[model samples]
Target: MKFNESLFDNEQTRKEFLQTTSALLISLSALSLLHCSEEAPQKPSKNLNWITTKPEKRPVMNVAYSPTRILLKNGIIIDGSGKPPFTGDVMINGSTIEIITPKQINFKGTTIDCTDKIIAPGFIDAHSHLDWILPLDGHPELKNPFMEQGITTTVTGNCGYGVAGFMPKSKYLAFIKNIGKGFFSGDSSTQKDKFVQKLAVSLTSMQQYLSYCRQHGIPMNMANLAGHGTTRMSLRGYESKPLDKDEMKTMLYHLEQAMDEGAYGVSFGLQYEPGIFATNDEIAEIAKLVKKKDKIVTCHMKAYSALSGTYPLKPFGTPHNIIAINEMIDIAKQTDIRLQLSHLIFVGTKTWKTCPQALSIIDKAIDSGLDVQFDTYAYHCGTSVINVFFPSSFLAQTPQIYEDKVALLKLRAQLELIVALLGFGYNDIQIINANNPELAKFNGK
Candidate 1:
């Protein structure tokens, strides 16, 4: 239709506005498509890819002490001797329990009023894996968590992990580098050298870590047990085989060296990989060495179930699954070697009503003057690596055989969730490495 010049100008303005709106709409649609493509799901496959970012760095605090020595006044002391607690003042010099007294003494140290507090030797974690998980530099949480629980010393290298000697020199160097950078600040070069030397010696045993404590003034003291699984893996690859004559000689030599190095004893995890491959004879040979050294032999026994259905072999009645415990008892009887069973409940729980009977067997052994003891955690749920869920028995009797993988998956998820809630990740969960430098390097990080 014919229109005036003013109408034409207005029509042009409206046309321009509509064109701009249309362009914007097209741009928005394209952006949405791009976003969707980035988030598109992958094809159904066996592998699931998940990416987690590193946790934020915690704040560093400048902790200053007026005097490096701390004196506790009028505290009840329980010295871990299984003795009665008594009132006393304790003096700590560096990390050692220097002095304890019923009456106050004139000392040039900073005094703390622990008038009513119960003082005891810091709780000793008989079994721990701190070498991997707890950073060398020590986090406030790491230090505080144990300190709050009254733990001053922790025993690591349990279940075939944290064996420093099993690692290569290069790997050990990297471990020292990480720990030095993270845990200590001044004169680390010397500290690193000393730590490396200790590992080198400890390969034969944990005596080096112990010696290092006595030699260079340690902040905390530790004791360790030689891992039978680690030794077997070192001698033979992950294959199941008996040791050859020369291999046996070498293994014995190393075992002797470790004993001489002051290892508290040898720990065997019969349920774990290479350890599962070991024969009773091989274990007895090692147990003999432990006895000769007058050291304890601790074992994570094979089976934790009493149900005949749970047995790997039917009608054997030889208790193939509980063979490790039976073997240990036999060894103790024969060699008179002291033995400690780790986590007595899991294995004893399955029989339900027969729990007392199982315990009685241990008690009878103790009464017969056999050097045997057992330890247990105060909780029902246990945390172990996901790989531990895999079946290793010949019968393939494991959770994997069950159609419902839900229980296993739920257990893993619960552990991860708890760890995350505690402000940690898998990386924070230490992996034990003996010969792997790449793995050892993570300890410092």
Candidate 2:
């Protein structure tokens, strides 16, 4: 059986097709950085031409301005208002939806006959890392996966980390090269220094990262949240402890600075360090800062299984998944800060039964006036560093745990439990991205 090739003729249909299928073709991180920085290496001739045909006063992100209009006519519209699908015309004035009507629109500078097409509000990738691709100096592309799927905007700084505008010189360059090209191995060793020195300019602060795009141009509108992992790592470097009084003060100061610089909110990677090191009390204190600023806090919880936990210990207690959910809810209740739950995955086959209970918890919280919401993946699996699979407490041992006889026995028990919880064996896992070039051969194997 074959799909009709002509489905590509419709712009909207084609966008959806490209968005869903691109991953089958290449790694997901193949996002294109289309900024027109004259310094893009290897090819000095390409550029990104931006249009400000309709600009607004104090435009979001301070992007360039101009007055413009577009009318999408005769389309099936899902207005996102809980109404049934209807045939209508949608008008846009710059980035705003100027009007929507059942009849033909009037005074359109650009009109598209979206006949037999699905016209809806632009989808937002609420958990995204598009900002990470923005600073990449080379290996640019014409479009990103989100944009191809008709996504107009994306939120980045997810899973408790993001590329900040104010990254230190070494961290900034290290991040760029690591994400762009996998780190240089034996054969590629000579290329590392060359890559970093050639592109020495690192984004300096939240303000600078945004301004860089405003000046260079970005295809989709983006909002970044300050990463709790990054902020804590900057001061503490994964020591497995909460911030002290003065350290907490410094953390608050940095958060305020980021908020003033245009961060949409803050996010936590509770499963990942140094997020795992943070206590509920510590997290609540940080949330209060967000509350004062009227911003949000998005958290990737400590565990995803109903009974599975890092340990039968503090920070991550038994029934870890439920404990993680309650932690965020508790923060919302205490600080009154808007809370966003990331992914909300239930790992391990046995844990899925707890879904109703999990949702019930969130439902009770929202019904009681606590501002809470969540997002999840369309599919079951995800990509991450292989080490993310283990408990942080176990991983934080002085000498890494792989070789010791007793440690290995203990680790085997942990692995056996993890395997039992998933029900699916190891075959389900696939390697997509690897930092070590030697391991690159195993990708997609």
Candidate 3:
């Protein structure tokens, strides 16, 4: 056909136009695909990639091996006994404290002159969950942060999340298998099945991790608490059900085993799943076991609010937060077991003002000769697995309105900072396992 000059383009020009048109079409198609993909529902990955291929090994860092001994000159020592601070020169040989003298000691090793600084036996975090939530490889840095905060020793894996070495192999395998299934399943039934499977696996895995720690010299000394929720989940499925006599027996046996394995005590996160389902009688039974072993019973009490109506049970009634605390108190009173009420501030809600009242009760119990100790964190608001938001009380009652403005503001700022830094918007940033290489890799960048 006799075409216009414009239509009768050269072969090269025609090819170029065709290529450009194709490229434009492909780009448009890709944009559409991207939009659709964004809108599409997410499916569980068939292949669970939670376990990273490259296992995390400790990074190489500078370690100073002293030729002889080190002397810390003119330092104030707080011996962690809540005693008076003393000023003196302390000499250290290897890991042992050699001597504390008013006069300086001649030593060949490194000398840290802490004239103005407070020299204390590292700070002890009596109750912390650093083991699970903290990045494994970042442990050194994480530990440094704690050290910077003057915390030398941290009691991790509390609230039924025992440390690595405490869990057994059979339980570990079961937990892994169950978690694997959960990673693939979608239906409620599958989820239920996976939950049961995972509970068993977790219990066994915890045992294995504990054993591993024993085999290798533990980097830092850790005291564990047998998680009541994990034990109950292992015995009973994820569905809320009463534990049978046999299951209770199994639970007690596991608790005893954990105690034998050098666990400090038993802990319960009664506010969380599985724990919420646990009855007072069930907890009492566990308390009895702990008492028999002369160990402590630490509980994360359910509700800590003035809105008593929110909880179906009345204040201090059955299943009430106060009731749970009282139950542990009763156990201590009856059996004389040490009882530690964990994180009083976070759970206290607006009752922060009323914490003194609660403490008074504990102090009274102590005065009456019942062993009881309670802990409060430096920060007012607390962080947990469920959510990252500040305590409802903090949001509900502003410092301008509340009587405790300074405390509330300090807590609020800390919570805000943590939320901002951690990108609390990202839901997937959960700390699953200690050996979770994905999080531990790249210096936790």
Best by lDDT: 2
Tens digits of per-residue lDDT for model 3 on 1-445?
A: 1112332233325344323222222111111100113355577553423222111321222224466677786666666676555555677877898776544455556888886555677667788765432323233543566667776556765665443322244333344333333222212343443233333345354455456445643345566677776666555434456788987887788888877776777888766555666777888888889988988888776654432222342333332344446666776777777788887642322333454666677878989998788887653334443211234333234323234545434543544443343222222222322122222331212
Measured by TM-score, how close is model 1 to the native structure?
Answer: 0.58
TM-score of 2: 0.74
Instruction: Kindly list the per-residue Cα lDDT of model 1 for residues 185-211, writing each as its tens digit.
Output: 222343445354344334334555555
RMSD of 2: 14.4
Query: Which ranges in model 1 have alpha carbons more than 4 Å from their true place?
Result: 1-71, 81-83, 86-110, 131-135, 139-144, 162-218, 307-324, 347-354, 386-445
Tens-place lDDT per residue, model 2, 288-402, is 9999999999998887764443545232334667878987898899999999999877665556666888999999999999999999866556654444555676656633433
Span of ten consecutive residues with least summed lDDT in model 3: 26-35
List residue ranges in candidate 2 displaced over 4 A. Answer: 1-71, 91-99, 105-111, 137-143, 165-204, 307-309, 313-318, 398-403
Indicate whether candidate 2 or candidate 3 has the larger lDDT.
2
Q: What is the C-alpha RMSD of each candidate to the true structure, in Å?
A: 20.9, 14.4, 20.3
Better of 1 and 2 by lDDT: 2
TM-score of each: 0.58, 0.74, 0.61
